[model samples]
Target: MTRSARRTRRALQAAGAGAAALLALSACSSSDSDSGSTTSGSSASSSSSPKLSGDVTVFAAASLQESFTTLGKEFEKAHPGTKVTFSFGGSDSLAAGITGGAPADVFASASPKTMAIVTDKKDNATVPATFVRNQLEIATLPGNPDKVSSLKDLTRSGLKVVLCDKTVPCGAAAQKALDASKLKLTPVSYEEDVKSALNKVVLKEADAAVVYKTDVKTAGSKVEGVDFPESADAINDYPITLLKDSKNPETAKAFIALVQSAEGQKVLSEAGFLKP
Candidate 1:
């Protein structure tokens, strides 16, 4: 081959080698960039909390019905694919249900004693936190016709009165108040929950009912709330906890968080619940 032709051939070979090297370098850089992007994406995904979803079944005291119901609606609104279902009744009964494997995701009791029932059975996932406090009140017929002004007044002769059952938190608190005041009261009936006791007064079936101040506030115009000093001695500390067998633990936790949050406290305070 001619010398010039050989030189040209060599030059072509060198150019091809340079082109190949450039292509290899570019591919390697792209591969590294793609690997880095994937790792960053994975890190971001892992760092962020998962979105909450599913049904959160809450078993709470009857007194928490109004405020908790409001919080439940807010929770559902914040999380589109979530729902909050509440079973409100006497704290004792709700605690009993939780310990009996009622499939509740959370429990908000009116008193620590009732919360202990579930915690002692190891049915709670976390320690119960006191979220609010409530004191007793005299719920009388509209216009204060009964003239029930104090805890002692409930003992007036021939007045039909109702009280929460002794096993329930409200009833237990009422007994404490009465004992503190050195007073005795015999109600016409012992209702199962605070709402029931308040209902009796609201429906005019009884002259008055000893229930929580929150309950009286919920009854609105249906009954008149009379604050008594003896209630100070029997204020109930409301507690809440996540259950161990929760089917939707994440959602349950979120609900509990909402209940204990500033926003939750606002709703509770507006409902006449005292801060813990």
Candidate 2:
């Protein structure tokens, strides 16, 4: 072979070697790009996976204690990285907690009248809406041994009774019903809440106590519930609101939404809360 032809062949082979090396590097670069894409996609998915954090303290009405507790567990289960702490008490007490800067994220009140204290004070949320309704009932010892069948029966001489103070919703409702019926009751004690009033009857502290229909339903074997026609006159609406100082707004709003959802409505209804 001639020198010129030999040189030309060597140059062509060198060019082919360079081209092969470039193709291999390109393949490696493409593999690295694909890995980067996968990593980015995974990061996005994880970031979008509901990063709800911080503790949410809820000050809710005493009537909602049982059902809200179950719903709280369900909420924590459904929402990762979120913790729900509940403070259940009289609606007035719960409102006081919220007003006292109790680190509460949400407030569920047994009465809009009580909630107005919060709402009227700060206009706390976007707006407060009714979630449920509850009315008062007479709770007596099992079988209603007192023969306390009606509101007028409560005023009978020698009958011992305990009633919630007028500040509470249950107490207010009781008063309205009594007023409607024009019956007078001289309760042995003015209790703080329906639960307290019911406790009085359950522990035999009083012969009869007026409490909520839901409270009686939840009391379960502890006290017998007696319905009166006048009770219909004192139905009260329950309202729930998200606070303005909520640290976990997303979680708080989500929790509120769940409480107002169809599932929550069913749970509340089953617990004797009237659907709003």
Candidate 3:
């Protein structure tokens, strides 16, 4: 072959190799840019997401036991590695516990008045929000053996009726209801919580109990519920808050969010609690 032709051929081969190297470098740079973009996006997403974990202790009113227990399970299912422990009692007692330095992550009271006990002490990390309302109901033995139909029926002679103490939310509501009706009733016993009052009826120890409608629902066939118009005058507003002393504030806040969420509302409504 001619020397010029051989030179030209070698030059063409060298140019081709350079072009191939440039293309290869461009492909690598593109791949690296894409990988970097993906990593940055993932990091941004992770950073923007809430991080919740650890044990959360919730202090709730007695009337919230069934619904709150269901919500606690849902929260644990949604957040792995998280555990929920509950201390259920009268709102007044729970408030006292919290004020007394109880190590609770959250507080859900049956009434705004009860929640005020905590809020007044600045024990809440956030303002208490009312999530649900409950109305009073007369809980009686199954089939209403005593045929107790109205609030006044509770005052019948020999018809033993139990009521929550005036300090607790349910008791306070009962008092308001009684006052609205201008009827005076002296219960056989003043239970500390709605559940205790309902238990008295369920156990046949009391012929009736002025408890929250939700409690009668929870008691199911064990007790029959009697609705009275006076209940409308004494509806209780339930409030929940994250305690300032919460060890797991993030988790506690998440739980509060869940309780205020649509799913939470559905569960509570099914349990006979009125929407706030």
Candidate 4:
């Protein structure tokens, strides 16, 4: 072969080899870019919702004891490593505790007015949402021994009736119902919470007590529930929110979601609570 031709062929081979190397490099770069994007997307997905672990503390109204207990159990079962602890009492009392720097992740109140005590103090992390409602009912001794059929029946001079304190949701609702009927009631005693007032009837301490319908249902055979029309006018909306000082906000948020979920509503309904 001529020298010029040999040189031309050698240069052509060198150029071909360089092109192959460039193609190989380009392929590797493309593959690396795709792998990097996939890794980045996975990292984002995992970070957006970290695995929930830790405890959620809830302060709820007295009327929510049973239903909330059931929900707490469900939450624990759903999240293996998580737990829920509740402080149940009068709405006013719970709100006061939250505002007083009690360590709680969530707050569920029986009335908007009571919830305002926390919200007004800017103690809530989120806007309160009404999850349920309750109406007043007359709880009497089993079989309604007193035959307390209506709201007016409790006014009998000799019959002793118990009422929740006006500062509490149950008491406020009872008063509203009484006011709606243009009736006056002077209870033998005023209790701090619905459970306290209902206990009066269950223990036969009083002839009857005005409490929430849900509480009456919880009392079951312990007391008889008397439905009154005036109660409809005094239904109380139940609100729930995450606390601003929550130590486990993610878990608290999950619990709040569960409470507002369809399953949670089912449990509350079965317990005789009204939907929001």
Candidate 5:
């Protein structure tokens, strides 16, 4: 054969081999999909063995960290073959996570507004029962060192004040308290959460901030909380709901039940939460 003819023949041979390999790959994939009839029978046997053997994630508000963590441990001890994981953050953050496809079995928020964001979506639970009540307070350095009495004092010249942004529940409640007292406070900074606002007071970076009473109790002796009658007008209501796409629905229901039980209220009360 001529040289050109030989090269042409070799190229055709190579192309034929490549085509054969492509055909083999397609055959394998098609075979797998077509084998569902054979695999389906055995799959059910394996699936029937065990169903509840995964983690249950609970997303809660940052303010519930201390109490919820303690209670989470108790819940884990009570349930065998189940693990409870917690993600505590701002209520709005937690709600966003749940509504944004974050895998969570339960959600406990600091306010009805944040909870509504979830309930309005797929996480709604009939009508969420109120779990706890939180009120605002003027947190200052240990003792009346700043001599801060009312919300107006937060804006006094030379008295640095910190507050939460209006997005957070605590900040909204603080705004209500200020509105009730008819006082406008100029804070040095607006924190993302109540804890951050309280931390500025504890660190002495800010002379005062309006935070939840439970946060004050959680701070131990690092700060002092003074009650103002305006707190009554700003009591925040906490509501918890079980997510609809939970991996462990039973565990989620139990957790919600525990939070609404008398024992749960007592725990919240000891942590400085008021009854609604």
Candidate 6:
């Protein structure tokens, strides 16, 4: 072969090899860009989605039954694979259960004092946040047959009135309202919780019940609610907290957030609980 032809062929081969290398590099760059985009999108998705799952048990005050139950359903719906179980009763009793080592993930009390029973103990509770406030109301049988209107009317002779035991929040608030009006009342029975006190009137076992406004509302047509001015002097604040021994801290925290959220406020307000 002629020297010039050989050189020309060699140069063409070299040029072809360089072009192939460029194409390989370009292909690698494009593949890297797509991989990086996929990685970035996955990261964003992971960051936005909360990691919450597992079972969560909540011990709540009797007054929270309706609202918190509604919220629990919502929380479970919002977070798939999560279960919410509740034990509703007097705040004092629930507090004792927690401080006594009950397996509760969250504690929501009708009164700050009861929440203190948990928060006061070492490693028993997290700092509590007041989620709602409630006021006293007179819950009488439908139509208020006793003609009871004011706190003093409860003092009427022969009226079988029921009040929560003084140790509980409802009872404490009732006492405060009574003291504010400078009126004395002697309830026929001091029930353990507001629900029981309200039940007394509900079952026609008593003439009336001095209970939380929310309780009357929850009772629906079963009872009539009467607001007294003295209730303004004895508002009870409801507080919620995550327990230290929470089996699912993330789920518990999410539940607390749901309770304090605007959606939670709407549910609570609908149930007659005043905003905090």
Quality of model 6 by C-alpha lDDT: 0.92
lDDT of 4: 0.94
Measured against the true structure, the TM-scores of the candidates, in listed sequence, are: 0.84, 0.81, 0.86, 0.83, 0.78, 0.85
Taking the tens digit of each residue's C-alpha lDDT, what string does model 3 give over 17-41? 9999999999999999999999999
Residue-wise lDDT of candidate 5 within 93-161, one digit each (tens)? 889888899988888889999999999885765467788888888899999698988777776888888
Candidate 4: C-alpha RMSD after superposition:
6.1
lDDT of 3 at 42: 94
Which stretches in model 6 have alpha-carbon errors above 4 Å? 1-40
Q: Candidate 2: which stretches are off by over 4 Å?
A: 1-49
The number of the candidate with the highest lDDT is: 4
What's model 1's TM-score?
0.84
Q: Which residue runs does candidate 5 get wrong by more than 4 Å?
A: 1-54
Error of 2 at 226 (Å): 0.5
Instruction: For candidate 5, give the lDDT.
Output: 0.84
- Each model's number of backbone clashes? 0, 0, 0, 0, 0, 0
Better of 4 and 5 by lDDT: 4
Q: What are the Cα lDDT values of the candidates? A: 0.92, 0.87, 0.92, 0.94, 0.84, 0.92
lDDT of 1 by residue, 120-231 (tens): 9899989999999998999999999978788888898999989999999999999998888888889899999999999898889999999998888988899999999889
Clashes of 1: 0
For residues 93-150, write the lDDT of model 4, one tens digit per residue. Answer: 9999889989999999999999999999999889999999988899999888778899
Candidate 2 per-residue lDDT over residues 1-276, each given as its tens digit: 999999999999999999999999999999999999999999989888466676788888888889999899888998777889998888888787778877878988889899998987893765888999987889999888878888899998889998898999888989999888877888889988777888888898888999988989998999999999888888999988988888788789888999999988989999998878
What are the clashing pairs of model 6?
none
